[model samples]
Target: MRRFVYCKVVLTTSLVWVLVDVFLLLYFSECNKCDDRKDRSLLPALRAVMSRTHEGPGEMGKAVIIPKEDQEKMKELFKINQFNLMASDMIALNRSLPDVRLDGCKTKVYPDDLPNTSIVIVFHNEAWSTLLRTVHSVINRSPRHLLVEILLVDDASERGRGNFMKLRGAAASRGQVITFLDAHCECTVGWLEPLLARIKEDRKAVVCPIIDVISDETFEYMAGSDMTYGGFNWKLNFRWYPVPQREMDRRKGDRTLPVRTPTMAGGLFSIDRSYFEEIGTYDPGMDIWGGENLEMSFRIWQCGGSLEIVTCSHVGHVFRKATPYSFPGGTGQVINKNNRRLAEVWMDEFKDFFYIISPGVVRVDYGDVSARKALREALQCKPFSWYLENIYPDSQIPRRYYSLGEIRNVETNQCVDNMGRKENEKVGFFNCHGMGGNQVFSYTADKEIRTDDLCLDVSRLNGPVVMLKCHHMKGNQMFEYDAERLTLLHVNSNQCLDMPSEEDKMVPTLRDCNGSRSQQWLLRNMTLSM
Candidate 1:
C-alpha cells in the first residue's frame, strides 16, 4: 500500500510538468508571430532608420540598393506606363470635345504693353498633345504683344528629350522668350509662377494662377474640385469637402471669390518674379525636386505674404499614372526624407500629427529644430490668432445643428391631470409618443425648473415632452403668464421658457419644446431684476 501511494504521487507530478511545458511553448510561438506582424507594420520606421545611415550616398546610394539592370528595366516600364495613360486620357478628352478651340477669345495688346506677362510651365515627361494644347491655348487667348516670355522648365525628361528642346527653340523664335531649366534631381511644378507673378505685381504680394489638371485621354479639365483644391489636413492627407448649399447658391452668379487655402496644389501657379527673389526663390539647398511646393507654400504663409487661388485664371496640366523613375531601389525612402524636411520646418506642434497618421515612417529633419526657432522669430510680424482667423479661416469648423423634432418626439400628454400637483411630485408614466430615448421634466405652479435641473430621463414623461429631472425652488421655479401667446416665461431670465426661434414662433401652439443648447440656463450667474 505504501509503494502504490508513492507511485501515484510521482505520476501526478509528471502530468503537471508536461502541461507547463506545453503552455510555455504555445505562448512563445504566439510571441514570435506578433513580432513578425510588428516588423511588417513598421516599414516607415525601418526606412527612417535606414535613411540616417545612408545619407552620404546621395542619388547613387539610392540606385545602388537595386541591381543596375533592374533599375533600368523599372525606369523603362514606368515611362511606358505613364506615356500610355497620358496618351489615352488625352485622346478621350479631345474626342469628347472635338471643336474645343485653343483660343476662345483674343485680347488686343497695345505696343506700349510690351509683353509684360510671362507664362512659366514646368513639366517632366509630358505628352505632346497635352503640352502643345497648353502652349496653343495661352498663345491664342493672351494678347500677342503682352506675352513677354514663356519659360518651360524641363524637369529632366528622359523620353521626350529631343521634342522638348525643339518646342523650346520654336517658342523662342516666335518672339516668345522660352527658357528651359534642366534639373538632374527631382523637381516639383508650380514654383515658377509665384516668382514671376510677384515680380509683375508690385514686387510685394506673391500670387499664383489657379491650377487644374487635364484628364489623361480626354484632355478635359480633371482637377480643381472644391475638395482637392482645399489643400490638406494635418496628417498630410488630402480631402475636399463639398461646398455648403447656401454658399453654393450665393456663388451661382459669380465664381471669382478669393479662396484662402493653407497650401496650393503643386501644379500651375504664377508668382511675381521680384517677390520670388525677395523670398529667395526655391531653397537651392533642396534636392532636385519634391516637397518644394510645401516649402514655398509654408514660407509664403509664415512670412507675411498670402497665397490665394485666383478664380479668374485657370491652367491645365497632365496627371501622370505613376512616377517614371525611382531613385534606384530607395524611392520610398527618398520621398520620405523630402517630406520630413517640410514637416520639420512648417508643422511645429503639428509634426506629431503626421507621425501618428503615418507611423514608422522616417523623414529627413529638413528644417532643423532651429528652423522652428527661426520661423518663430520671422513670424513676429503677425499674431497667431490673426493667422488662424483671417488667413487660415478654414481651421475653425462650425458646430453642427440637428433639429430636435428629428431626434425626438415632442408630443404633450392631455391625459395627465396637473391642476393641484406640486412642483416636486415624483410620478411614473408611460411615454405615449414611443420616443424612448428623450428626457422629460416638469415645472410646478409656485416654483420653476432651471435648465440645469432638467433631468434627461426618458422614462418619466407620459407624452413627447421628455420627462427630465428638474430642481424646483420657490418663486424662481414658476413661469410668468404670457397674455398674447398663452405661453409661460421664466421670471429669472424673462425668456419664454418654451418658445422656439421667430420663424417657428408663428404656430398657434408649441408642438414640442425645442431643447436647444442655447436654451439651457445657469441660474447662479443670473441677476434677477424684479
Candidate 2:
C-alpha cells in the first residue's frame, strides 16, 4: 500500500514540471517575435522622383503594362486595417460673445448703394473679445453706407445656433446685410474677400482671402505668422512664412516696402460671390477643413486667375489647437493623403521641393497618384519661366560664382597706374555669366606691391564704357561667358570677343579695340531688391 501511494506522488510532480517548462518556452518565443517585427519596421530613407511624365493607365487602345509584383504589393499594403479605422470625437466649440453694441452707428443698405466690400468671417470656437472687436472695427472704420454685408460663416459650434441667430439679428436690425453660414469645417480667411471681391469685380476672378490668426485664451490679437504664409521660392518650392509684412507693420509701423507674393494666406480674405460658384467654390471632396486653402490657392493661380493681399484691409482671428480625437479607423490619414493629392496636382514640377524641405513627413506615393490625374486634365499653361519673366519682372535671381581655371605665368609689359607690382602675382578672374549677359569680373593686386594694369595709358573711356577695379586675380580677370550663345564678354566694355572656331582656344580676340557698337554689351542687374 505504501509503495503505490509513493508512485502516484512522483507522477504528479513530474507532470507539474513539464507544464512549467512549456509555458516558459511560449512566453520567450513571443518576446523574440515582437522584437523581430520592430526591427523590420524601421523608417526608410526618403527617396522621391520628380518625373516629367505622369504615371497612370496608358491611353485608350494602347497596351497597359502592369508589373505583377508591384500590383501584389499595392494590394497588400492598401488592405483596409480595421484597427486603423478610427474617428475623433467632435471638438467642443465656443459660441458665446459679450454683449457689445456699436451705438450711434448708422447702418447701410444694399441695392441702391451696394457695398464696395463684404467682409466674410468664418469661425469655429472663437473667443468673444476678438470676434466682437473684428465686427466693431469694421463698423467703426468702414464707411457705413458703403459697407454692404458682414457674412459670418460658422462651423457648427457648441455655442448653439441661438447665439449665431442673436448675433445675426443684431447686425440685421442695424440695416447691415448679416448672413450666417453654418459649417463644421475651417477655411482660410484669404478665401473670403478674393472670392467675393473678384466675383463683384469681373465675375471671373476666383479669389480667396488671407487667413490671419487670433487667440482664444487671452483673447489677444495675433496675425498669421510668416511661417504659415505660403509662397513659391526661387527653387519653385512652395514655402510658408510665419507672418505677412502688413501684420508685422501693424505693431512696428510700416517699415517694409510692398512686394508681390505667389499665394496669400487663406485665413481672412474676400472674393466675389458670382465667380466663386462659377469656378466651383471650395473643393467638395475635402473633409472638414485642413488643406482647403492649398487646394483653393493652387486652383486660383493655375486656372487663369491671381491672388493678392489688400494692404489696407485687416482682420483678426484665433488660431486653434490640434484635434485631440481622431476619425474612426484613422480617416485623418485619408485627409493627409488628400493634401498630398492637392499638392501634386497644382505644384507639379515644384512638388519635389516639398519633399526636400520636409523629408519623411509627406508620403510621396499617394500624392503622386492624385497629381498625375490633375496634370493630365489640367489645361497646359505657360511655363514657370514665362511667369517669372512677365508677371514678376522685378523678381531677383541670385548671383552665380565660379572659379577661373589654371592661369599661365605671363610677364607684365607695362603698368599705367603708379601702383607697384611684385614678382609672382596671381592673376585670374571669375569666368561666369550673369542674368542678361552681365558677368562678374575680379582681380587681386600682388601681396608686396600695388600696381594697376592698364592699356594705352587711358584710365577712362569717353564712350559708353564702365571700368570696374577688382582685387583677387580670379575676380578681376573674370568675364561673362554666355553658354547659350557661346559668347565671351568683357565686363568693362560689354563687348563680346571673337573666339577661334576651335573649342580649346584659351583667349578670344576682340573685334574692336575701341568701344564700338559690336563691342558694347548690355548689362542688366538682376539682384533681388526686396
Candidate 3:
C-alpha cells in the first residue's frame, strides 16, 4: 500500500512540474510577442488581412506596389521552390479570406451524430510557415467536437520506408475518420461540417471539399468554381470538367448538394478509417505522388464505394508549377512506373489504350502487380469497365484507330494544322514533311481525329477545318468517318473534308466530296509520320 502511495505521489509531482513548465513556456511566449509588438508597430497588412479592419486588400486587381527588396526576395524563393514562398511568408497565418460560399449553402446543417475526423497532413521540404498555417486553419475553423486529431506524415524529405503508412497507423487509434491534405493548404470557415456529414451518411463515401486555389505567384486565396467536378482522360491525368446536367438534376434545385465525381484531382480528401482499410488503403508500392489519385478513385468506385465532392465544404491549396523536392530515378520514371501498375491491375484489356496514348509508359517496368491483382480479387471489386460504364458514362473509351498519323494532303505534302486558324487560334496547316509534331493526330473508334484534347471541328459547311476542345458529346465535336469511301465526312455539317484546288488556298475547307486527289490523305504510322 505504501509503495503504491509513493508511486502516486511521484506521478502527481511529475504532472505538477509538467504543468508548471507549460505555464512558464506560455508566459515567455507572450512576453516575446509583446517585445515583438514593441519593436515594430504591427504590419499594415495585418489589420487589412486578418481582422477586416481594412477589407479588399488582397483583391488588388493590378499589381500592388511591392518594394524592390520584396521583389528580389520573391524571385529568390521561386528559385528555391517554384512557388512564391516569400509572398507566402509575408501573408498573415490567420489571414481572413472572403467567404466564397453560395447563399443556398449557408443554411445547411449537419446532424449532431457526425463522426469526428483526424486530418492527416503529409509533407517533404514544405515551407514552415505554410505548413503551420494549414494546421492553425483547421484548429481555428473546425468545430472542436468534430475534429479528433491532426496527423502529420513526414516523408523525411528524402528516401524513407513509408512515412505515410506510419502516419496512418498512428492516427488509427485516434479518430474514426481520416483526412489527407497537402502541407501548404488553407481551410475556409465552414469546410469541415459538410464533409463529415456526408461521410456519416455513408461510411463508404470518400468525400472531398471543393478545392480553392491559393495562388503560387501571389499568396491570394482564390475562389474556385463550384460548377466543376474531378475528371480524367485516357492518360489518367486529372482534369476539371463542368458538372453534368444529370449530376445537377440530382441536387433538386439546391446548389449546396454534394456532387458525385468520376475521379479525384488528388491532394485533399477525407475517408472513413474502416472503409479505407477494407478498400485496402493506398497501393503501398506507389512512389511519391502522381498516378495515385486516379488509382484510388478507380478503387473506390469499382469497389462498391462512391467518391463525391462536397460543394459546401471548401479548402484552398497552393498550386505550384514544379515540385520542390528531389525524387530518385527522376519524377517522370516514377510517375510512369506508378501509372503502369495502375493500368496493369485495374485497366484490364483497356490498359492497351493507355499504352496507345502514351507509348513510353509501355516500356516502364511497373514492378510486381501480383499482390495488387490478388488484393483486387480478394476485395471482390467490380471490373474497371463497370466504372467506365456507370460512374463515368461520359468518358470516351479510345480504341486502336485504323489510321494513327498526321492528316496530310498527299498531293501538296502539307500537313493539316490547327494554327494560323482563328476559330481555335490554334487551327492550320504548316509545311508538310514526313515528320509529324503537332501535326501528329489519331482517329479514334468514336470517329474523331484528336491530338490530346483537341478535336477536328466543322463549325459550318464550307468553313476552314478547325480544332476545338473535345467535349465527346457527339455535337459539332463529333465526325463520322467513311473508311470504305475514303471520304472524311462531318456528321453535323454534312460536308466532306476538302483541300480546295484553287491557287493560294492554304486552309483545308469543307465542301462536296468529289473523290479528288487533293482531298485524299495518307496515314504513315511509324512515329506518327505524315
Best by lDDT: 3
Best-to-worst ranking by lDDT: 3, 1, 2
lDDT string, candidate 3, 331-416, tens digits = 78888988998988998877766665567787787888899899899989998888877888767554445666567776677777
Give the range where candidate 1 is weakest over 10 consecutive residues by summed lDDT: 1-10
Q: Candidate 1, TM-score vs. the true structure?
A: 0.45
TM-scores, all candidates, are: 0.45, 0.37, 0.80
Candidate 1 stretches with Cα past 4 Å from truth are 1-115, 157-204, 221-228, 238-254, 328-331, 361-389, 396-530
Candidate 3, poorest ten consecutive residues by summed lDDT: 1-10
Q: What is the lDDT of residue 146 in candidate 2?
A: 46
Predicted candidate 2 versus true structure: per-residue lDDT over 179-204, tens digit per residue: 22222222222222223333444444
Worst 10 residues of 2 by lDDT: 1-10
lDDT of each: 0.38, 0.34, 0.71
lDDT of 3 at 206: 97
The TM-score leader among the candidates is 3
Order of candidate numbers by TM-score, starting with the best? 3, 1, 2
**How many pairs collide in each candidate, listed in order?**
52, 84, 7
